[model samples]
Target: MGQLVRGVWTADADFPRDADGRFDRAASQFRDMHVEPVAGRYHLYVSLACPWAHRTLVARALLGLEHAIDVSIVEPVWQDNGWQFSDRYPDRLHGARYLWELYVRARADFTGRVTVPVLWDRERDTIVNNESAEILRLLHTAFAPLARTPRDLVPEPHRADIDAINARVYEAVNNGVYKCGFAGTQAAYDEAEAALFAALDELDATLAGRTWLVGDALTEADIRLFPTLVRFDAVYNIHFKCSRKRLVDYPNLLSHTVRMYRLPGVADTVDFDHIKRHYYLCHRSLNPRGIIPVTGQGAYLRLA
Candidate 1:
C-alpha cells in the first residue's frame, strides 16, 4: 500500500485509489530499454510469486535463454523494506539486501514502484527494462544468437493478434485480480469481480477445441495469460474475491492451464507455495492476521 515518494523509500503514504474506490496502478517509470545481448551482460530480478515476473521467466525458459541471461529470485513475501533476497535466493549479482537497492543503484533519483521482472544490464550497471511485457518480448528475440533452443513466441504474422489479446486479457484477467483484491468498496469489488469472471468465461469458450490462443502456435498472447490462469484458482479465486468461478469450473480453461504448466520448463516456474503465501500474507490490508492458508495446492501441480 506504499511506494517511494521521492528518491527515498517511504511507507507513510497510501495506495493510489480512484474516487470510486477502484485501485489505479502506477505506470512503469523506467523506459528507453535497449539491451546488448551477450553472456553475463544482463540479469533478471524476479519473485516466484509475482505473475508479471513469471511471464518473463516463461519466455526465458521457452526461448532457451537460461545460459545467456541469468536470473536471481527474491523471497515470496514483501516486507516494509520491499522484496528482499532470502537464504534460498541471496543476491548473487550485486549482493544487495533489498530489491530497492538495485533501483537506487540504477538511478539515484528513481521514483516509482520497485517492481520485479527487471532486466538489469550489468555492464552499464543499470536496469534496461522493468516492464514484464517488454522484457518477455526481448527474451523471445534479444538473445537468439546465444539461445540453445530458439523459438519465436511472438511471430510476425500473429504479432497484431497477440497484442490485441494481451490488451484484453491484461485488463480483465491479469491485472483484474488485483483490481478485485484492492478495491476499496464493495461496489468496486463487485464490478471488478464481474469483469474478471466474464473475461475468464470468454477465454474458456475461446480456448475450446484449440490448443493455443492465436494462430496454430503458442505466442505471447498465451504466455501473457498463462501466468494468471495458472494462479487463478490457487489464489485469485479465494484471495482476490474472484470467486464467481473456479478455473476448474471452466473445463477448457482448466485443461488449457494444465497444458501450459506441463510445457517443458513451465511447470518449474509454477510455485503455489510462493503464490499462496504472498497473497495471503504480504498484503496486510487483505489479510491482517498474516496467516497462511492450507489450500492443498500440491494436487494443482500434479494435474495433467
Candidate 2:
C-alpha cells in the first residue's frame, strides 16, 4: 500500500481515505500515453494476484499476443519495498528488485502508487500506460494485427453495451470490494458492501438466461468481471469482510466463472495459490497472524 513521493519510497504508507472514512483510491499515473503495435517493442509487468492486472493477462492470452509482447512477473506477496522480483520471477528487462524502481527509471521524480499491469515501452524504456483498462484496449486493438487469434473481445456492435456494463461493474464490483475491505469506518463499509451485493444481484440476474455478458460471444465486459468473481469466494468474501453471500450462492455467476475458467489459456492465467497468498499474507493489518483459511475453491474452479 506504499506510494512514491517525489520518486522516494515512503515506508509508512497508508491507504488514503476521505473525511467520511470512505476509501479513496488514487488514480493511476501514466495515462494519455501511446504504444506502437510493433512486436517485441512492448513488455508487460503484472502480478497474478491483482484483478486489474489479471484483466490484461487474460486479454493477452485470448488475443494470442504471447509471441509478440512478453511479460515479467513480480512475486505474489508484496513487501515493505512493494512488489518485488525474486529469483523465481526476476525482471527480464532490468535487474531492479522493486517495481517502484521501474517507475523512477521511467520518470526520475514520479509521484504516485506504483501499481502493475504496466505496459512498458521497451524501445523507449518508459511506461506507456499503467492503467489496466487502457492496457486491455491496447491489447485488443493496437496489438490486434500482431495477434494470432481472430477473437475480437470488444466487438463493434456490442461496444455500447460492453461499455455500460464495464462502468457499473468497475465501480460497484471491481473497486467496491476494495472499498469494503479498506473502509476506515463502519458507515463506509456498510455503504460499499451494500453496493457490492446489489451489483452482484443484478449481474446474476443478467446472466441467468445469457451465456455472455453483452453479445452472443465473449466480450471485454465478461473479461473485466471474471477476475473479481473468481477471487470473490476465496479472498473478498472473507478477507474483505464481504460475507453477505459467497460467490457460489449465485448459481448463474458461479456458472459464468466456471465457463470463463474453461476457456483455453484463461485458466492458466489464474494462480489460485498466488491469489490466496497475496491477499491473506500481504494485508497484515487485516490478518495479523497471516493464517490462510482452507476452502474447496480449487474443486469449484476445475473443468472436470
Candidate 3:
C-alpha cells in the first residue's frame, strides 16, 4: 500500500487508489535491460508467493539461464515495512536484509512501490527492470547464446499475435483477479469479477483445439497466463471471490494449464506453499484472522 516518493521510500499506506475504492496498481519505476548476457552478473530478486515473480522464475528455467542468472527468494510473509530477507531465508547473493534495502542501495532516494521479479545488474549495482513482463522477454531472448536449452518462447513472426493475446490475458485475467480481491467497493469487485470470467470463457473457447495461446509453440503469452491460472482455483476461487466458475469446469482451459505445467522445468517454478501462505497471511486487511485453509485439493492436483 506504500510507495517511494521522489526516490525516498515512504510508507504511503494508501497511495495506490483514486478516492473511488477501486484498486489501481502502480507502474513499475525501473525499466531498462542488459543487452549482454554475462554469467553471474545479474541477480533475480523474487518471491515464490508472487505470481508476477513466478513468471520470471519459470522463464529463467525454461530458457536454461539458471546458471547465468542467480536468484534470491524472499520469505513469503510480508512485514509492515514490506518484503524482507532473513537468516532463515538466507540471501544467496549480496546478503541484503530487505528487498527495499536493494532499492535504496540502487538509488539512495528511490521512490515507488518496491515490487518483485526485480532483475538486478551486479556490474552496475542497479535494477535492470522490475516489471515481470519485461523480465520474461529479457530472459527469453537476451541470454540466448548462453541458454542450456535453446528455444524461442516468443518468435519473431508470432510477436504481434503474442502481444495481442498477452494484453487481453493480462488485463482481464492476470491482473483482474487482483482487482477483484483488492477491490474496496462492491462496484469495483463486481466489474472485476464479471470481466474475469468473461475472459476465461473466451480463452476456454479459443483454446478448444489449439495446444498453446499464440501458436503450436509455447510463447511468453502462455508463461504470463500460467501463473495466474495455477493460482486461480487454489486461492482466487474462494478467497478472492472469483468463483463465477472454477477452472476445472472448463475442459479446454484445464487441459491447457496442465500442458504448461507438464512442460519440463516449469513445474519446479511453482510453490503452492508460498503462494497460499502469502495471500492468506500477508493481506491482513482481507484475512484479519490470518488463517490458512486446508481445503479441497483444488485444480493443483489436476496439474500433477
Candidate 4:
C-alpha cells in the first residue's frame, strides 16, 4: 500500500489502518469537473487491476465515449515506486516513464497518493479528476452531447435514489471487502465481514425478481457495484477473506453480474489476468507467497 504526499510518491509500510486495526481508506485528492464536453481532450489513466478504476472504464464504454476520450492502461503489477510505464506499456498520450511523472507534470509540487482512474485534461495539462465516482459522473452526463448512446446512467429523477443506494453499497460492499482484507485484527475482520455479508444478503433478497439495482433500467449504481461483485468470488473470497459466501451462491447477484457483463462494450473492460495479479501480488501483506489461484473457473463463468 502506497500513496502520494504533496505530489511526492510515498511507499506505505502497510495498509492504512486505524487504532483498532480497521482498514481506513484515504480520500481521493484530485477532484475537478469538465464544464463542457470536449472530444479528444480528455484522457483516462487506469489500471485494469483496480476495481475503482474499472468503474470508470465501464462508464466510458456504456456512454460510448470510446472515440471521444482516449485511455491509457497501466501494467498490472505495482512495484515499490508505484505505477510505472514501459515501452510495452507506454503512456499512449505522453511517453512518460511513470504515472508519477504525469502527476508531477500536472502539479510539480503536488503531494498526494497517486491512484488510477485519472481523467487528464490535456488542454490544461492537468488532471480533471482522479476520483472514480466523479469521473464516472462526468462520463455519464458532462459528455452526453458527444456520447454514442442516448441512455443516461444517472437520470435526474433517479439521482436521489441512486445516491442513497450508492452510499450504502459503497460503504458495506464496495469498500467492505477491503476493510475485511486489510483488517489487521480479528475484531476488525469480523466487523467488516458481518457488514459485507449483511449487505449482500439484503441485496440478494431485494433483487429476487428485479433485473437492476434501481427498478427496471440500469443506472450508475449498478456500474458502481459491478466491479466489486464480479471480483468477489474470484479474488476477494480467498485473497481478501470475504468468504462468508461466494457471489455465485447468490442467485440474483450472480444473474445481475452476468446481465451487466453481457452488456455491449462492458466485457471488454474486464481483465481477469490484471485483476488476479494486482490483488495477489501487489498486496504482499495479504499474500506473502504471492501465489495466484488457478481455479478451473475462467474469469467469467456462468453462474450455475
Q: Judging by TM-score, tell me the better candidate of 2 and 4.
A: 2
How would you encode candidate 2's per-residue C-alpha lDDT over 74-177 as one tens digit per residue? 99999999999999999998888999999999999999888998899988889989999999988988888999984788888888899999999999999999
TM-score-sorted candidate list, best first: 2, 4, 1, 3
- Predicted structure 4: lDDT: 0.87
Off by over 4 Å in 2: none
lDDT of 3 by residue, 73-111 (tens): 999997766788998786677788878888888888887
lDDT of 1 by residue, 238-303 (tens): 788888888778888877777788788988888888888888888777778987766644565565
lDDT on C-alpha atoms for all candidate structures: 0.84, 0.92, 0.84, 0.87
* Model 4, runs deviating above 4 Å: 296-300
By lDDT: ranked, best first: 2, 4, 3, 1
Better lDDT candidate (1, 4): 4
Colliding pairs, model 2: none
Q: Which candidate number maximizes lDDT?
A: 2
What TM-score would you give candidate 1 relative to the actual structure? Answer: 0.96
Best by TM-score: 2
- Candidate 4 residue 220 Cα shift, in angstroms, is 0.5
> Of the pair 2 and 3, which is ahead by TM-score?
2
